[model samples]
Target: MLDTDAWWRDAVIYQVYPRSFADSDGDGMGDLPGITGRLQHLQELGIDAVWLSPFYPSPQHDAGYDVADYRGVDPRFGELGDADKLIAEAHGRGIKVIVDLVPNHTSSEHAWFQAALAAGPGSPERERYIFRSSGEEPPNSWKSVFGGSAWERLPDGDWYLHLFDVSQPDLNWDNPEVRAEFLDVLRFWLDRGVDGFRVDVAHGLVKEANLTDWTTTSTILGGLDPAGPPPPMWDQEGVHEIYRSWRRVLDEYPGGRILVAEAWVAPASRLARYVRPDEMHQAFNFPYLDAPWRPAELRAVIDETLEANDAVGATTTWVLSNHDVVRHASRLGFPVGTPRMPGIGAEDPQPDAALGLRRARAATLLMLGLPGSAYLYQGEELGLPEHTTMPDEFREDPAWERSGHAERGRDGCRVPLPWEADAPSYGFGPTDASWLPQPATWAEYALDRQQGVPGSTWELYRTALSLRREHGLGHGSVVWQEDAFAFRNGDVLVLTNFGSEAVKLPPGARLLVSSEPLDGDGRVPTDVTVWATL
Candidate 1:
């Protein structure tokens, strides 16, 4: 068992995108029961905890990020009883649970949002949301992260802010009601036995007090310059206060419940602020995720992350891929310095699959050998690549329609998991249909095909995780080796070769595992990573 007090500090958390993880009722969508049925898969995979993406009542405008109710389970995902059962089952297997919480905005169908619309211009309900009255133009020049204008106008000559989609409206955090409501919402889940929360848009809750106009015409995804002045809409000073309050609430519970910030703020130093002693326990290390696959770039990010988190008295949290971004498996296939895209299309330049898989495996080994917590995106263990060839007509991500078809959006990476290669729907459910169609090539990556196969990605992950736990590598500090590309965690030395030629190992070092097989000379080949005993 993990140390109960600080399990999150070094825990391996698995992210389950509920809609695409597993389907229980053959409704063509994954649900709570589906996740519960698959807990053993995670247990066998050796993950310390499970962090499920939002499954609350939502319109799914942003794939469940547009929450309609904070305290209830959506009927499509299953009833509240299913959630309770899932939590109980997870805890029974010694696995913790972290649910996603969307506090920055709510679905327009939410009771509060609906009431605000009905209550008109100056009602208390309207005060709960960011409603502004301006002639014809929007309150400001801010653009939605999804696309287009950030404001939606009503017949009453009033407009409301929506940083994402029109179906999701931003809430006025300055309002006391909003604060109190979220506090109660936290208690509701805590009372139901959730171990923690992964806060969505954690840095965006408190925007600039005046709702100031952004002089530049850029979307939230474009991001603020880390070296430049802060943007008015994100990473505001007020956000820290909100998290401080949340930290207190989390402290009130037993078993060390944690709060993870999904803050996309830049420069490692600025990102560290969210994880201060009294604020969030951990924040996603996005700079590391966005780093190029080269050894120097990876080492630089690792050093910055450790240093920054050290200054804040927090353990670093590392993640390679999530629901919002492209899968690293496909991303690493391209050359270094390639810009990140929402999704790849049939017409786009395709990745080198063999090279991508080799690097992705090497990266995962290096990530596991690091001295901090790690988050694994679902299907990554099976070496799943984005369904880059998915037909445009079936695309459903809000970014697709919102961007006027210019951007393909994130649907490619959200394809359903494959369990049994020969079963219907690849054993994702009892039926043969899924919300997003899996590629025909996916059969080769199914769990059944790789479960016990030597050198398979699934087996590689299982072996690495087992070794990581046995060696206490996650709790060890990193000791840099003479080679800038290598570091030692405890007695295990990890080295990655990014050059075109092979690299020789020390004479006395004994090899534990290699992301790829060594050459005839027993040298690490290009794009390969190896872990050995000192």
Candidate 2:
């Protein structure tokens, strides 16, 4: 059930990538009607809310991130009326809805962008975006997150900055027009009864003055640098003032509306600023997600996470996997220190599936037992792994092309979900075709096949979520145990065995649930996590 008072503080939100979630029209793609029909499945899964990825009208250059309209839904997904119905239906079921807001950039096809291009260099239309005069060499040394130079030169010899794909033009947040437009956009969705927004590129809305050159030779992933003076393009102090204004707008509405930042900032303290009392409500705990699967490393990240959030009077948010990264079910199987890749292809080294699933289950229990909110990618509960062998011909991710085919990109994790064991398209839609082809082995992981099966990942999640709410685990404070790998939250103790040997539990402890069954010796085995009362 949704908590009426500050529900987002400890809510478990499920992210739905609209195109691959479920297709109701048999058009080979998922849509609003399709998602409306599948609400029952999420309700059964026990999630407090759903965070739908962008469905705004666009050319699909970046899979709907390049929004052309802030107030209307894409015709392919559904009309504005359909979105209204969805919000009402979801609210009736005691579930909140959060929609993605892409404020950093807009599609080149957006009316504002087209006018900017037609208005030439110095017009008011062009001021809404970053446009500068340049020679043949281009204006700056900034690199695109997708690939190539960050600047795109037009026929008029002027260039516009696009930190991502060329079809997505970065808005000049320095301009009053751009800032005021987004404020209106925020109120537009909140008026439609959305619970909140997942702000895309939340750390990138503001850039340093003068647009200086960045010459660091560091390898960056998802706009994150390990350690150094960060690039001027991200996490600027001006971004905070923007969010503070946004906070005021959110406070105007009742029912505790929230704003979640998808910021990838560094040093736990820097991330905490995004969640300050007057800023955002929550920022994703990426350090926890990026930490290697080891006891020492995991413990350190947890401590850091808790301390950082506590200082700012904000609840911490935990996430294992999302649309832009490899699913944890496959990622945890790789050796520690392996650089996280966008996606794996058939030629890539395959992960140990059995080992990955075991660790993933254990990780979920540990994360759910923590004192804060958590997010689950759509199919992670089903133990879904990446479609590691997708052919290059079927790739749709812009990164694949932008990187000149060196990276396989994230299409593998965005494949449609399997709902039935024997149904066409695994019951993802009425038609046999899915946006991206599904793996032939997907049937075994179908929801119908794992429904009531003991030891199945689906059943494990159902049981864990039920217990989480029942025991107030999300609201509990952690007390570290004698073993660094174990912690007690209220009356429940959660321990994870990261070593190769089995660990014996203390005497008189009553086991409540475990990721895997105990060994014959009644000890916790390697890569296993258990919750018990002592």
Candidate 3:
């Protein structure tokens, strides 16, 4: 009999950024009840699971990623009961729940950090975190991922490592207490009925002892060279041991509780190490996400990813956009080979909305047709474009200040979702004011506007997801075609045209779906995807 618990392997998981998902109480910020109220939307959208971003007690310094308390939800989101309810309610609809676990660092306001600050350097309390004496310079020249220096100085003539914003202090995993604490944190959520965890900075929990600086820019968090020598700060051999222990903890629970790593390692082989049968179940396919729309590049990434995961007997996960980067809709709208940046701004070349939406829809079909799991960021179903024109004054991403306002940060992609047209907050809530401003153009793509509309992006996503299950295409091998981005998933074949001209469709197969209307001659147009039953 097939095991039912391993739902994660090919699950089409939807990612929810809590503060922007929904605003139940009209506080202008999304909360737990808001997510609960909107669970039906996900159920109807045909996802297998929902991976929520961090909503733990926090200073909101990094938008809840800098968790202050691992065991409790922030009051702004709801209490512990709401979390329990969200889990139970989601499971009721046959959707599994995976919450974010930020083990890499904690908010400086955390009890341990607060106690360490009061205990000063060298004390046992201070040992819980990375602390060094100020001797005319920082411990090293490691820069913070957000910007500036990775080390922050305190009033007591000692410095602590942040890696991110100063408000987030990196925990010293070498300490036994730290490891034991995270084990307990895992149990705490597992006990709460969470099916799994999306570990934040999974490659960073353990650092090299010497704290050697690669002098690699840390402006991107563990910005180690993917093709160069392994850096001292990330993807250390020590991280695997940590996961081995975590794997054991997960096994103690039933229902196949899983852990998904957010490791940024590369070359496919190094990434395979994190999911070797005994460790994590899956890791984000950042390499695939970063690949441009070119057919050759996209095909190569898929081949490399499949080969790597095949080595470890693990599943590969494909994600296009997330909270941390520019929306793929806008990103793909740029010139075919342009780089994907942290954020888009008014000064930057604006994306061609019509052209971008076309490519995005095609990308969605292409991603879902792959032979592994897929993740959908909150508003991608509506074909939501990034709010590239957010007012500079309202920008709050740490990157803005860290880069001296030169980078513009990630606020553009994080604007609240529009649910209804001509309604307050576009029906994201009863109020018109959301934490981040919503662009007026979003109304055209609101969920209410797209529901039941034929050929809308939302309908396309729904049809694709439904077809994925009916054909069991998610759990198979691919046979790549040399001429175009074409591959077979079981009895179905997915073909995409990245070339300027039309590509002839394979004969003798039933056409199931196409991203664009078939050309007059019924060929696949540029930037289009089509599925067929072979």
Please identify model 1 stretches exceeding 4 Å from their true place. Answer: 1-5, 217-223
Error of 2 at 21 (Å): 0.7
Q: Which pairs of residues collide in candidate 1?
A: none
Give the alpha-carbon lDDT of every model. Answer: 0.90, 0.89, 0.89
lDDT of 3 by residue, 1-534 (tens): 233237778899999999999999998999999999999999999999999999999999899988999999999999999999999999999999999999889999999999998987789999999999968699988888887889988888899998889999999999999999999999999999999999999998877898887676765633346768787778889899999999999989988888999988887888889998889998999888888899878888999999998887888899998998888889998998898777888888899998999999999999999888999999999999899988898898989998888788989888888998989999988987799989879899899999999999999999999999998877877988666678889888899888889988877878899888889988889999999986
Model 1 Cα lDDT, one tens digit per residue, 1-534: 233249888899999999999999998899999999999999999999999999989988788989999988999899999999999999999999999999999999999999998989989999988999998999889888888999999998889999899999999999999999999999999999999999998989988988887866554354457877687888999988888999899999998899999988888888899988888887888888888887778888999989998887788999888887788889888887897777998888888888788889999999999988999999999998888899998898998999898889999989999999999999999999899988999889999999889999999999999999989888888888885478889999899988888999887889999998999989999888899996
Per-model TM-score, in order, reads 0.98, 0.98, 0.98
Q: Model 2 Cα displacement at 295 (Å)?
A: 0.9
Model 2: how far residue 344 lies from native, Å: 0.5
Alpha-carbon shift of residue 9 in model 3 (angstroms): 1.0
Model 1 per-residue lDDT at 270 = 87
Per-residue alpha-carbon lDDT of candidate 2 for residues 292-410, written as tens digits (9 for 90 to 100): 89888888889988998888778889999999988998998888667687789999999888888899999998998898999999999899998999999999988899889888988
Over 4 Å off, model 3: 1-5, 221-223
RMSD of each predicted structure: 1.8, 2.0, 1.5
Model 2 alpha-carbon drift over 4 Å, by segment: 1-5, 217-223
Model 3 poorest 10 in a row by lDDT:
218-227
